[model samples]
Target: MGQQEKVATSLAGAVSERVSASLTPVDEELERRYPGDPGTRQPVHTVYVPGEQFAADTIRSWGDRALAALDEHAPDAASFAAVLGLADDLAEPVYTRVRAKLEREPIEDLRVDFEDGYGGRTDADEDTHAARAARLIAETYAHGAAGNTAPYLGIRMKCMEAAVRDRGIRTLDVFLSGLMEAGGLPDGLVLTLPKVTYPQQVTAMVRLLEEFERARGLAPGRIGFEIQIETSQSILAADGTATVARMIDAAEGRATGLHYGTFDYSACLGVSAAYQASDHPAADHAKAIMQVAAAGTGVRVSDGSTNVLPVGPTAKVHDAWRLHYGLTRRALARAYYQGWDMHPGHIPTRYAAVFAFYREGFEQAAARLAAYANRTTGDIADEPATAKALAGYLLRGLDCGALDTAEVTRLTGLTLAGLQTYAGPRRGDLTPSAK
Candidate 1:
């Protein structure tokens, strides 16, 4: 071989050996433990409600309420069509579709918040609210609200600060106990411990959950929790190193997700209230830190909400839609597939933005994926990364009900059988259409 080629080969061999020598048993164990990606259903957005207002039928009626708001504010389908930039002719059908989907399955994740939303009630009042929340959970399960509510339902306890830690624990204890006694824990039940500031808080929460499980006679680790990365301390250590890794490690496999609290996190960074938004650079930085720290650790990361909220007089309604749509689209672009939705008026734009984001790239992604699957050389080259992305895109579409198996198969030249084989069994019926 030429001298240059020989030198290149020698350098490659040296690098490979160095990499091999750097491997340790702990690294191998970590790989084995994490294994594949965490199997979790990521909802598009979570709806936050005050604990006092939470009830079994609250989520059930959200869709109708949202639709009514749309009708009153926008007046006609054409108004929403204008917001979405769709052709006038497609407006009514699109409106009908969005409304139907919302009615059939409105909220994807619901957070009954005791922190900010519920505010600081008196000790007796807080206890009363907790009991009411527990009873609501039981009634919801008995009334089949679990089936109708978002697939992931949980409560957000107050931050585990020194002054409020005991209060938070008490609320959780009372609520869980009441719910369990009334009926039973429903499927997809989780707890959200918010404004996490330290790794010890996470470990402590896990231990508390374990104790509760044992007391309730439930299986160990049956309860999972999510940590809210709100304050500045949660994302970065005093020494400037990322702290999310330590937080996840402390959870010991019960940390299902890491959620951003836009306003609180931004405020913690000293950003003025006017600038604390989901799309603000400060918020983006926090989310990036979270994504980096949680990468491949099976911890789903979510963005914060658009607090501008699509609620005002009729004259100001369009402006509200514009703001909400812009924020939602920005979150989706940043790869934060899930975010927070505060107002029912934000519902129409939420689904529209997600559907449009996926639909915009559908044709090209499908064609390239089909070419990759068929092993055909085409104008659009498919790399391993691109293939994975294409599969994920289609999977997200399917999961959100934006695309059906028949449509996916017809566009990609892949049958359901092929998708199942290629993507694995957990994909459910996300296969290509049967020929």
Candidate 2:
């Protein structure tokens, strides 16, 4: 075999050797809360979902009333927009108040997303606008434009049927790739694959992109894709996510994340359209799939948007939903490692949720990962005895910084001379609890 193939094989062996058989289980409380099966090891990355409508006024942009229903309201009501983090390009009046109220918000971990082409009309040509968005995002993000925190681009398509359309659904392939290639796409683009149904649709996507990368000479898989679990197929417990999960699993190294389409998932089920999906049974079922997907796989999963309900001017309504958002944010924070937002107000909540969720727990997870990464040349261990687990560990460690030579020496109890017995030094991080 050539050198690269040899290197890969060597890595596989080293990781296979190091992980321990007997270890403490992760917290059950966390397991119940997150549905991660205590095995999914994907390194967490937080992102802010964009609001459906950015009100011209800043008041509307910050926090709006929730779609959560009261005895009086209809069940099909739209939710208040929980703005995770608003765009820096605030409307003058709205900006002043929102900035005054929420300035210097502790927001480093959150990624603020910009809406690309909302109304059916593309601000630039549909293709051109997408490209422009890619360019602008990279530029602005690099310069620390969105108040120093990175700004991402979310391409919310102009609905399935819109004017000045994409013509056919198949054209999404061209549209997305064009956008990513328009400028070098950033790590921040959440290519929200909305309204996904069949496994073939996803598989076809992976195949098409593989072909596109070859033709364009773009390095393989630089652009990561996220699937929005929206349709009835995703919401119904009986309908089953097994096919979709298999699709994501088949993606292997390609999919970056899975986001639950809260409103869409709600609508798909007979859940009242008026409210959000936080406590709904359908959303819970969807979250279960998310937990399973992330359990042993390295792919990250996210909860979906709290469709921009108006957190109105009334102190009673505003504070009530704000508190509700706070509670829901924490619930999602605990349930999954991540979630979505509609208004900019939601960013602080998301960020806080992240800090609360991981500040303490992540250190332990990081510590455990370090322990795994440091094992010696003879440290053969097995859970399921699969190649994927070993492969996963290497990738996870690489992302989370738990693997290095020193840790290897400590875990293996091997000296430099002893290391020579192995063909070469070990490398790569292991994945999700060595499953």
Candidate 3:
């Protein structure tokens, strides 16, 4: 006590204050621009149906069809495991969770596509279909039909190109107006701006949404959109800069995600139809760019869909299923965490691969995160960043029904809130206890 009391501080408080004053703006900028993940539940896959083809029973029909595909081809856990090369220990749990997910929530996010999926149509016809889609979606949400509506639902309008700008805007206006008139927008409403080629397009979208909000008396920035990276120009500008990053900035905090467009992006790179898949080098390059651009911007990245459909004979279906399963698993491992399902038949394999990935890594991730939270020594010396990742992994597994609450709690001795604290920001504030 005598020695400690005799010490005098050499660093002055005024110096610390001056340093902080110099860095205050940068601190605020970082906090405002990159607040990290929103800690919301992200869907596993988004299922797209043509605007005209979407109906109230669309979700239910997809679930039934997926279940039928499983029954006819896989038939049991062992067969399904064999087809996807799932581990023996994971076969039963993964298969059971896949079946349950399909039955309970076949489609987490649903996009009624008016872009390529709907093709060209007269302006009046497109407008009518847009209104109809909006009305059906609103009605489903209003009626509280859990099985009929996806957790997130929206439409994908045409690109803002010279030829289709007016049409796309009109469709968007009609659909949004229809929702406004139909008891207001649902909580899970999402929108996608497809084929964005420039940062100005994202800016244009923000202005459009602002105008819509003003016209409807809604709060500013209430509507957020996913930017579809369909064109190469969206990735790299004429000046050779990363246009996608600029697009996110141009969004003004309204960008929810960056969704890769498989065929369009691949074709832009001159990839042949046979090779224009999610795992193609071209596709990977674009998505990787998108991933980097969206890294800390509160915007997510989603992989694109495969054109291959799980149809025809059992052998053909099995082959398609295997391909889809493998691609989904690969995307999951890469941390894309979401993809697009073009067909109802893709649902079975989508959930199967997702469940397998989460369950396979569950125990290890939980243990490591638990150890980090408790400040205990482990095989791997995990830092704060890794603890955050591990927490996120388990949270995703829990969110998508791959990991049961009881099991997660039992394994980690942490509740959902505790896990969220580790997953969320403020890692420096974490103590050596499972708070």
Highest lDDT scorer: 3
lDDT for each residue of candidate 2 in 1-435, tens digit (9 for 90 to 100):
455543334366556545432221434434433332223333233344333332222222232221122211312112222232322322222223223223322122233223221434434344554444444445544554223333234444422324323432333444455555556555545555556666655665577667777866778875556666777664333554465576565564566677776777787677887665565767777778666756544456676656544345444444544553564545544455456555444443343333333323433433343334454232444322322333333333323322333543454444323432221223222221111
Candidate 3 deviant stretches above 4 angstroms: 1-8, 425-435
Q: In candidate 3, where is summed lDDT lowest over 10 consecutive residues?
A: 426-435
238-342 in candidate 3: lDDT tens per residue? 999999999999999999999999999989988888888999887888888999989988899999998899999999998999999999988998889999998
Tell me the spans in candidate 1 whose CA falls farther than 4 Å from its real position.
1-27, 87-93, 145-148, 415-435
Q: Highest TM-score: give the candidate number.
A: 3
Query: What is the Cα-based lDDT of residue 372 in candidate 1?
Result: 92
lDDT of each: 0.78, 0.44, 0.88
Global local distance difference test of model 3: 0.88
TM-score of 3: 0.95
Candidate 2: segments with Cα more than 4 A from true spot: 1-117, 122-125, 146-183, 235-241, 250-252, 308-310, 314-334, 357-435
Model 1, residue 149: distance off in Å is 2.4
TM-score of each model, in listed order: 0.87, 0.55, 0.95
In model 1, pairs of residues that clash are: 416-432
Models ranked on lDDT: 3, 1, 2
Better TM-score candidate (2, 3): 3
